[model samples]
Target chain A: MSRLAALVRGLDPRLKLGTALFLGPALWLMGLVQAGVCAVALLCIVAALASGQPLGGRMVRGLLVFVVFWVAVKAGLDAVSGMEWAQVAAGAGDLAVRLAALLLLGLSLALSASARALGLAVAWAVRPVAGGERAWKLALSLALMVHFLPMCLATVAEIRQALARRCPRCGFFLRMTVIPQAVIRALGQKTWNQTLAVAGRGLDGPQAWEPDFSWSGRDTRCALVAGGFLVWISLSLPFLS
Target chain B: MITVTDLDYVYPGGQGALDRVSLSIRPGTLVGLVGANGSGKSTLMALMAGLYTPTSGSITVDGCVNPGEGRAVRAVCRLVMQDADLQMLGATAEEDLLLGRARTDATVARARELARRFSLLPAWERPVQTLSWGMKRKVCLAAALLDDPRVLLLDEPFSGLDYPGMREMRGLLRESRAVGLTQVVSSHDLECFIDLVDQLVVLDTGRLALDGPPDAVLNHVRSHGVRPPCSWSAGQGVRSWDEESL
Candidate 1:
């Protein structure tokens, strides 16, 4: 696992995302909705894996849930306006591609960039916007919160289990109110204990994760390729219309 | 140096767990809080451990004392806690050790070293859930000892240990104390605690009844039957085991 982590440290996270974005619109122009988009999205998935991000199962389940939502939204839209099959396909295809790209891009970014490194990168990238002590803290906290987002997901599952009962109005009420309330009720000593542990040690200092990027031939070439892809995609927009 | 004077604690449900309790523990003494179940032993320990606030009276540590100051109080004095399962906050054995020491480069090696020495489970990078009850307890103890604090508060330090295991534990505690570490281990088992604790405390209900040397208290309790006289006064507290054997 440590070796795998070391291997991931070799690749540039930005390059992975750039690759996905470059391929997405290019594939859309190729008129191969499922094949091209799927290929691009699948490549992004491979990047996520190579970066040591374990999201295969999570992505599968999330896409399944998104399918249900897409169907419901599609049905509502069809009822409101009679649309042609080409338009429907485009809408659904775009929807699927957009969703897949977003998911895979997110995974790539997460896998390639660590919380500390990303915080440093963000702190560097958004220099003017992120210029205060509070801004730095906010950026660090946001990074930590994003990194620990999966912890809250387990709580959501627990809440769903609690709401696993037969009802219409009450079930609706629970769906609306249960999750947040359950989280509140379930916040126990462990969280406070961990915080106390950190605070007690005086370890909660300003995380000066200053970004350190060095320009190499690979980086320069990658950036040029990315820029060209964007230009091509921009020119092809009218053709799609 | 914690002095609990007329300390009383009750739960939110209006359950009177602790009555007025007064006790003073001098520095450099290994005190063990002991009692039967529901005797307010854990309640008073909880007050000292900073888990709960006394309803009335004062709970002080090293002359600096306050009620419900567990977070601050706990900083000076660390508690390993009674429940081992609740102590784990990491995803894996290595991560468990890295819970607080994540920033350091030697954190993994340090954790692995302690895990090996302290009988921590899942020998590999397996999840904490894979460990046994005893293994979890050892890991919790290792985590507590990692900081090497001025004071160590252990609840049932030897609950799941055999004779040899307890001896190994004693060696660990001995090493911890050799360097000015004040330890308070709250436990009911005084039999195996022959060489472990230096001081003894008995909580009869939420109130303190006995505080003195372990040997003196042990002899007194034995002579008068485990339950002391309904009303008793302190004199020459614990007679050293020179009379018997430590």
Candidate 2:
């Protein structure tokens, strides 16, 4: 994990996003879909390691819920319809792997990407299709959304704790009394003031859409390797299907 | 130094908060802002901190004007908000201090030093919720001072603090004053700040009622709905419960 993380820690965010974007469609096309799943899983692992994020209990629980509701439900339905156990098992395994790959990709991206870097990536991606102002606005909105997520979570947690302390015997409904107001307050004047503070710390004014990414020797080598792999997989598609 | 020249503020709903409120605070002094509830103390402090633009008139912090170049004013004068929880953007003290700022090795070291100075080193890694209100206040103060702003506007700094906590804050304010940091602390509670403040500025119904040295303003302090210190209230008062009985 350390070795994988070290490799990914300094990997350009743009390159990471591009590779993830390309990998998804490529993973869908391969006949032996496990190969694509494994590849995505590897990337997710690298991302997690690089970001130094622990695989927390909450994530495990969420994965369990997803598997039960999404993967297991389909498998059980197939079996009830008299599909063979072997086929059902195979389908379930395939779906589970694919789901895991997608989840990992998302987790890695969320963990490793900074708001500014992600904003730059989004703006750059949209610049050709959209003009610069719209691109930058969309990017800034996305960055602000990313920044607000953690703040909202913390606010909820703090409100919960405050209620608990003031009323230990407080009913769940009673405890939730402040949640709506807290959310409104957090998203309202508080968020605006925070944004002002952030801007005051030198993020104000007309921002140039200059993304700080440069192609290095390593990027070229990785690109070539990825291109060769994609070509080989596409060429071998007929045999797999 | 902060100079407010004929400052006027009106809320969006046509409610006036401050009207022609003019005052000047010199460098390296601790000034107390006293007013009743909704008396424009907080509004004036917010204006000084550059949180809100003055609807009319102006505020100059170290020669930087508000309503424009507000960021410059904020850079020189930071406000420690009344609600510590609202200002604490980080789960821990160190994280809060690092927000919106680069966390270089030097910055991290400076954060540690500030935390220690503010007696927050023990709870530096702990979640802000785990700390007492005083500790949380201290963390907010430390976070504000991380950039070493020349002026601090502390709104209700002693609210909810115990006796020892109040003493500690008084000492901290005194120490900051010694080092030439201008501070304007607004609080409805006058007892806590009376001894520490060099001058008392009283606001009554969005207007300046009195402004003078604390020793000279005890009569106006009571007139403006504030209870002066016990020493002044007991015998040297213009009117008191004892005096009224006689």
Best by lDDT: 2
Q: Please compute and give the TM-score of the first chain of candidate 2 against the native first chain.
A: 0.75
> Where's the lowest-lDDT run of ten residues in candidate 1 chain B?
B224-233
Tell me which residue pairs clash in candidate 1.
B1-B62, B60-B65, B216-B238, B216-B239
RMSD of 2: 7.4
lDDT of 1 at B62: 64
Q: i-RMS, every candidate?
A: 6.4, 5.8
For model 2 chain A, the run of ten residues with the poorest summed lDDT: A200-209
Instruction: For residues A1-241, write the lDDT of model 2, one tens digit per residue.
Output: 6665555645667777787786566555555655554556565574455344433335545655785678888899999999999999998877776666666665566555555567768878888899877876776666667667766887778877777788889787865676678668766876766654444333333253355455678767767775676666666456554
lDDT of candidate 2? Answer: 0.73
Each model's DockQ?
0.07, 0.12
lDDT of 2 by residue, B1-246 (tens): 888899999999899999999988888889999989999987888788777899999999998999796878877877887767656645457666665455568978999988888888888766555679999899878777776888988988999999888877887887788888999999998777676778889999999999888778877687888878776777653322221121
Give candidate 2 misplaced runs (Cα > 4 Å).
A1-56, A72-93, A108-144, A154-182, A199-241, B83-112, B119-140, B158-171, B218-246
For each predicted model, how many residue pairs clash, with residues at least 3 apart or on different chains?
Answer: 4, 0
- lDDT by residue (A1-241, candidate 1, tens digit) is 4453444444454455456555555544543443444447454444545433345456556755875588559856964698876787677766666555555555555555555445545555566675756545654565556544655676677767767743434666657786677775655444554444444332344443333445567667757765675555555455654
